[model samples]
Target: MKYSIRKLALAGVALTLVAAACGDDGGSSTKAGGTTTVATSTGSGTGSSTTVKNTASDTGVTETTIKVAIHGADLSGLVKAGAIKGVPEDASVGNSRRIQYYLDQWNAAGGINGRKFESVQITWDPADPKSYQTSCQKIIDAKVFMVLSAGGGFPPDSTPCITVDGKTQYMGIDAVSAKQFKDQLGNFIGLAPPGSASAKAGMEILAKDATLKTAKVAVLRSDWDFANEAFTEVDKVAKAAGINFVYSDAIKVANLPTADANKNVALTVEKVKASGATSVISMLNFTNFTVFPTEATKAGLTLKYNILEISSGMCTSFSAGQLPPEMNGASCVTHWNNFRLDNTGAKATDTPFEAQCRKDFEATYAAVDSVGKGYPAITKTNPGVPYPGFKDGTGTQLDMDQSYYECNIMNVVKAGITGAGGNLTKKTFQEAIYKVGLFDVAGIAGGKGSLSANKLWLASNVQQVAVTVNPDGFKAGKDANGLYQGKCLSPLACFRTVPNTVTPLTFTLS
Candidate 1:
């Protein structure tokens, strides 16, 4: 069982990485960033039931409800088990609730094509390999039309499978061997491409800054699927941007914080030092990102610049000041900007669109909280669902990322349904998604979200990248323990588009 769990984690990590890379878009035409008034799509449906909307399609569809599922980790359980600390129990569950909030709003306005959205939460601890199969089986048994967002990685091999009319179908959103499984699993649609856009942004930073570009650069990453793709993408950009890599190495992704893990990071740092590398581009998971940089700083290695790709978990670590001082000047490529960190006063925007998005987000958070706390019946439709404490969220990093994902899910479903015209089915949904071109997410994450034709990735044109600096005078909010958190010293700068190759553009950040 232990060995199987390990194997599943590796596979799960691979698929997650695949989604991140796909988000890279690999296209070159530059589109200016910011919000533009885009039209919304409308759908038609006939429903009688309060929950399920009866659609012509019978699979995972009814007269009133469109059945979907969200599969991921139970963060509340993790907190209780002592597996995690200092993070909100609501981190994952709150994300799920946000989905419900959006659905409730949609239902109030009129559901997609007259069919209300209903989602089942399937959660398990990632540590328990058996839990993967268990949770997946539950999703399969429920016969959901699709699985939207996965809060954490799961082993691909343990995914539940079912058959209808003698045809086999696999339970969803497969990132493992994405291209290989794409045709086979017609129902799978990726939520977001995390690493690809960041890779582009980080490389651009290196290229545009002369003092940093001339200095020796090193690349460090874990031996995982996304890390490999990140390194390759970064290396390609570096070579083209006239920046050269002085040293590079891959370390094992598992068994972290152990002696071997410590040794591996320490060794990687030594290689960076030996090669006279003054800057480092780290493409690693949260553990490796925190561990490697901390070790580098402890070794007394002063770096001119450091760029990192960190997940929401690491964002918590950064807020907690667990990251080394070497990261003080570093820039992170992540999903959303921290309002607390925006020194350019983007939070005080004058645009109605921007203001409305912000207002809606705050309202959504409130709605989700009320629903979680058993306040409004509309919010608490999922009675038995777990709702984590609201005090844990800061509306900066993880919460923002989760909200953006919910927006993505809503956008895609609307587009797919509208494109379906009169009928909604697994086949039509997939086809509509493929045909989705130039989708605008109504200023989500302070940028326009889009999906290109036939692509499984969602791109955020002109997204914001936060810069790390001294946490003085820029405090926004508090953590669960009420510790003051620091903000990014830079404004949420805009980019017209993220290209596959590096393109240097000067960004003025005081």
Candidate 2:
């Protein structure tokens, strides 16, 4: 059954996004004698005068300003040298820039519930696990109202930790991570693929496809604790769906550049073939994904693979014709529509919502050059063309996801403030979030946003897609040139949602 938060809440259960027996301990409060500055609106609406206040008692929230922090890999430097993998470096940098854009726009449009939004920037090395802890600690010290750790996929700072209380605490690590983060930091939100549920969704798709219905399936994912947890949950659902799970192996590889990376890929492929598995479910990065088929081809092995498409990690690479032909019919489990370059026609018939979204995308894309070269395809060629590049443009699903993540958080912040009314404390703000449950953000991948009362996460809504090779070559979907033509971008694909529901707390924690 699809777990509905409204149903549960209506039933009188006080469950939070993270089901815990503990109460908020105010662990994120500022240290004694430490002071933080907050921005607030002195008046109301767009013309309201903004004011800043520095006080010891008030950590993040103030009369005029609400302070937050964003932690992620040093994308600004990485994208400039063309060193980042998976999504384009421009997209990575664009994600951060998009966050800033959202804040500025919100302030311009009267700000969040009359108070402006501000953020502390902390860019850590992606490969350094300690950086995450240090960054979160910094946010805690700063007493930001919320923390958005916008790593490409998964929190770079999250890992299993033994708390001072001697309990096994997972902060931003797994299902319990959000709670742990909230316990240590203030309010927090993140965008991570519901891997196991998505895997089950993919299995349902396979069950319907004649070619893969009875194929011997193998599960391949990173050997991280979180990935393992996802694999375990998926294994249960796949078995329930009558999937022939012939093999399961976790790839214990890091996303860094190392000699063992290629070796690990070769070894993983060997394991898959030796198990006689005909199909694979991969929950790894795009770089590792490309390595899988490449190694398979070199070994003369034939196989089909399905991968998780989230965080703009897989779509851009795939849509850019980066995959091999042998993997033509490979499937992807995604919650959002993949982005395609569009240059069709310019029309104003789109709903105000869409035009606004596209406008936001343009604003962010235009500013990409402010940090560095921006996207090589976009700004480097035709400058100031709203949608730049080969008209490859900036309004793809990847860009939208960044906007969605931040905007949704902003929505929560606004809702919390409005709900709190005259008394907007951290506790009241949280209460406001729960009171204003099931928010539908204007433009998400699925067109509808689902949030639970009091929960800081979105319910899993996944769909499966099979790569439809385009013999006519990938065409940039026509941008608004007066009329829009064609459906879906080049490298055509077909998708069907799996008739499945993942209940909250459904995945096993152990």
Candidate 3:
């Protein structure tokens, strides 16, 4: 099962959307060593004011300011380059979507004890570990009531809260997957995917695979933050299952762009082969996923493959039809299944929840750039359509938009708040975080008594492995791969499952 902070918040989403201009905080606090400047309020609703304090111990002085950390995606940058709609690069979809989803649901359902919930976003550098601590310290300094999906793994930080030993509800992102992060998981009503989500699922997936069960396996992962949690879980699972948990000799690739970087995959395969393993399990950057597939193909060695049993490391690339040929048979599993509108039965069953979810997500995303030609599609030349793009000038082109990786973490946060078993509120959200952990997030009937797995908050549950090959295409039937009739994205006319072909077709049918 996939697990991260299960995050789903950004900035104060509870703030009422006011058409009247909300002015900036003109006053500044000078009590602390540095001046505390209050951020201007953007909404005109009856917004409440809270004092955020700075760490007296860190600065040896008390500052007056509630620092709510937030990520600022320069969406305009991508829009200008015709990459995306003019939505703010860092908008609700990043984190606020979760907060808004929850708050809207709560408000509609009768909020926490009838009180509205508030949220904020804080972005940190995935490369800079200090920012992680700093963001947490800022929250502590602000003396806020609690933290939310304040952090993530792909981004490498989870909810950083004040020492639970000190405060009660220091809650934020629920699950703590990384072993190293376990130290950070003190006392906060937890809201993570299951604590054992990745480790258990990764192992189970590998073990169940008949072709890979007895095969020697190599685990490749980052030595850093969130991704390491899934990597570690997969490693632990692989070891427990008696699979060759080869890593010492396996390559330790970094997210760097260097000449030596290209060699990492060959070295990894060499280590795997040296260990006499037939397969390799990689838990590395999504960006680096191309490494092993390309390198293994070059090495003329192809075997069973499994990657991303933890976080969505390079998994999107797979579904995007971008995995290299070597990964043709490899599988990457996640708890959240891609909700395809084409699945009529599933659409009928989960349509309401999924629709509301998709609607909430898109609306929140559009909130930032409601009038831009970013989403909903925008273009005069409808090369493949009558409408050109989804956005028909009203906002962004949201039409033609198909399924991508849905950060179910948002759903987790939403579930936590809803399942708190109490009314919605900041405090209730904190409780909701833990409630999510204790209860099944998916709320599917006859779901319990299974292996150790957790659910997202919305009562939605899915675990699917996606395999997508990239630019070039190939074919392998069960006759070739045994129990695996692999298909490739081919544009070439080669109907035979020969070796490799370029311009591969989009799909193959028996």
TM-score of each: 0.64, 0.67, 0.55
- Strongest candidate by lDDT: 1
Rank all candidate structures by their lDDT, best first, as comma-separated numbers: 1, 2, 3
Candidate 2 weakest ten by summed lDDT: 164-173
lDDT of each: 0.47, 0.46, 0.38
Name the better of 1 and 3 by lDDT. Answer: 1
User: Candidate 3 at 119: error in angstroms?
Assistant: 4.5
Candidate 2: tens digits of C-alpha lDDT, residues 1-510: 111124322443221121111213322322222122333555664353333222222345555566766545554333343334334543435456646776787789866555677877755554444454454444445556555544344342242211211111111212223333344332333333344444555556556556555888877676654456556766776767677877776776654432344467668877787888888767665545656777887777778877754223454323324455666657666654323222231111323544455465555655445333544322321111111132232333222211334455455556665565433455555576666666654323444444443334443355444554444333444344311223233222222222232222222112
Better of 1 and 3 by TM-score: 1
Task: Report the lDDT tens digits of candidate 1 across residue range 109-218.
Answer: 87766667787887765445456556655665666666656443443333323222111223332222232233334444443333444465566655776865688888
Candidate 3 — worst ten consecutive residues by lDDT sum?
500-509
Which regions of candidate 2 deviate over 4 angstroms?
Answer: 1-58, 76-93, 127-130, 149-151, 156-187, 191-193, 254-263, 308-322, 338-352, 374-404, 442-445, 453-455, 469-510
